[model samples]
Target: MTTYAVQRSLPGITMEQLAAAQAAAIEASKEASEQGSPVTYIRSNFYPADQRCTCLFEADSKESVEKVNRAASIPFDRVEEVLDIPPMQH
Candidate 1:
């Protein structure tokens, strides 16, 4: 599976909205996986000041990632494959 980053520009978004979006994404991913296009929702990072959010997912292709977002009714600007580097252990 390849990791992907879904970028969105959401102006005037609230915490409640963010939470709802995450929940929707999870549900949509699960549905997609059950339907055979396996996808996992990793996490999301929101920059309130910039009104931007990036969501991470592991899937077979960029189209899988985009399908999940579209199923969840989440609007995204771009979807790109990414390398996920873990933090260094002390």
Candidate 2:
């Protein structure tokens, strides 16, 4: 699976909306896994002050990531394939 970063901009996003979006994503993920195409929602970082968020996911392609976000009714600015770099040890 490849990592993806999905950028979303919500001017007035709330905790409730975030929870609903998560639920939808979970549902989509389960459905995809059952169909043999697994997509995992790794996590999300919310910037309330900026009214923006970046969600991370693991999937075969960006299209799968977009599909899950769409199924969850989540508005996103774009999706980009990302490479994860480990932190340097002191």
Candidate 3:
């Protein structure tokens, strides 16, 4: 499975939501992270906003990302899996 970085953006992030989402994210992340299932950081971060919350998920696939969002109940309005760029070796 190829690792994927997923981006989720919302139109307002709350403190309570952050906590909930964090837990949800962790759980979802664990699915791939544990036993070295190609999950890396499972990393998630955000700030209180009057009208938006932007989040990024580094994992294995769009489906995994969706699962995370669904688990978190974070009301994701958009998601984009990052495309890996080949490094140019000198």
Candidate 4:
């Protein structure tokens, strides 16, 4: 699986909405996994002022990520593969 970034353009999004979306994403991912299309929703960074969010997911392909978002009833602007670089401790 590879990490991907799913960008969502949500206008006037609130904390409650974000929480609900996250939960839905998790359930949708589980369902997708059971169907053989594994998708793991990692975490998200939300910008309340901009009404947008960037969510992370691990899946076989970007399409898989998008499928999960759609199944979760979440609207996303784009889905692209991303690289995760860990910080080095000094």
Give Cα distance to truth, residue 4, candidate 1, Å: 0.1
Model 2: per-residue Cα lDDT over 1-90, one tens digit each: 999999989888789988888788878877887788889988888899899989889999899889888888888999999987879999
User: Which prediction has more favorable lDDT, 1 or 4?
Assistant: 1
The local lDDT score (0 to 100) that residue 49 gets in candidate 3 is 50
Find the number of clashing residue pairs for candidate 3: 1
- lDDT (10s digit) by residue, model 1, range 28-55: 9999999999999999999988999999
How much lDDT does each candidate structure score?
A: 0.97, 0.88, 0.59, 0.92
> Residue 80 in model 1: shift from native, Å?
0.2
Off by over 4 Å in 1: 88-90
Show the colliding residue pairs in model 1.
none
**Residue by residue across 1-90, what tens digits does model 3's lDDT show?**
454444456455566866777777677667656645444434554544545555556655666666666755667666676655669999
RMSD of 4: 1.1
Stretches > 4 Å off in candidate 3: 1-13, 32-42, 45-49, 83-90
Candidate with the larger TM-score of 1 and 3: 1
Local lDDT at 10 for model 1: 93
lDDT of 4 by residue, 1-83 (tens): 89999998999877888899999999999999999999998999998778889999999998899899998999999999999
